[model samples]
Target: MIDHLRDMGLGVDPVCRVLDLSPSTYFARKTRPKSARRLRDEELIPLVTAMWEDSGRTYGARRITRALVRSGRQVARCTVERLMRELGIEGVIRGQRRRTTIPEPAAPRPPGLVNRRFSAERPNQLWLADLTYIRTWTGRVYVAFVLDAYSRRIVG
Candidate 1:
């Protein structure tokens, strides 16, 4: 920026004053060498992107860093994270959610039992029910379970 401004015949002092910069700071920056770390990061960005694509765009920063290191590159996870942010590329974050057992719109909900309190003083005093699904070689299976609160065992 200072170089461009000075190229237009704007003297250092005038440019500094206009941009609210100190002359000493400007001269220091002008004389300072580029950081080796920054240069390395610039070079690492392309390599990182390639690895990300190689992993089908599903490798997050930690995995990318691991792949880079395994390929004989020394890079920090945080550095890869920052570069990924700059490139606007990211890995897909996957999590499991129940997809089956959609409730009917007119289905009635039972009144609260134990008032949402799971613990019970007796084995049959409270029961908890939950529905979930499992995947097998044949197909998907839906399951419903009833548990005794006090005994913490399957009641049904």
Candidate 2:
């Protein structure tokens, strides 16, 4: 990475200083042989990458690990998870649903005492709730109102 930055017209000494890496240590480490685990990871990276792309980037660590295991490759889910994090690839999930009128069958039922009659002779007898959206330069803002049935004015 430091070499790449240097190639991009950045000075190596400043880059190394910013990364808190000593120049001698960096070069020495680069010359050292990779560990067995690192060698295995290097071999698996390409396979994991291909599989992730094949799945349209929808495969998370667990799914990727399963695919590798099914192909007779021995690897742990956690290692795959770490690799995915390092590579900055992730599976997308559906966000919270926006439906407001969904019914729940298992929820306790309330009696229909009003029968949809919104009229009221007294101020506090009935109330109506409504939601409206106001558009502004930035975005739409939702406003909710509680109206008194008798006076047709906002109650609460």
Candidate 2 lDDT over residue span 40-141, tens digit each: 889988988998999999988889999999999989999898888878898766455345457889999988777889899888889888897776667668
TM-score winner among the candidates? 1
Tens-digit per-residue lDDT, 25-128, candidate 1: 99999889889987887899899999999999999999999999999998899999999998999998876655665788899998886787889898788888
**TM-score per model over all chains:** 0.52, 0.49
Prediction RMSDs, each to the true structure: 6.4, 14.3
Q: Estimate candidate 1's alpha-carbon lDDT, on a 0 to 1 scale.
A: 0.90
Clashes of each: 0, 0
Off by over 4 Å in 1: 95-156
The runs of at least 3 residues in candidate 2 whose Cα sits more than 4 Å from the true structure, single-residue gaps closed, are 1-23, 94-156
Worst 10 residues of 2 by lDDT: 92-101
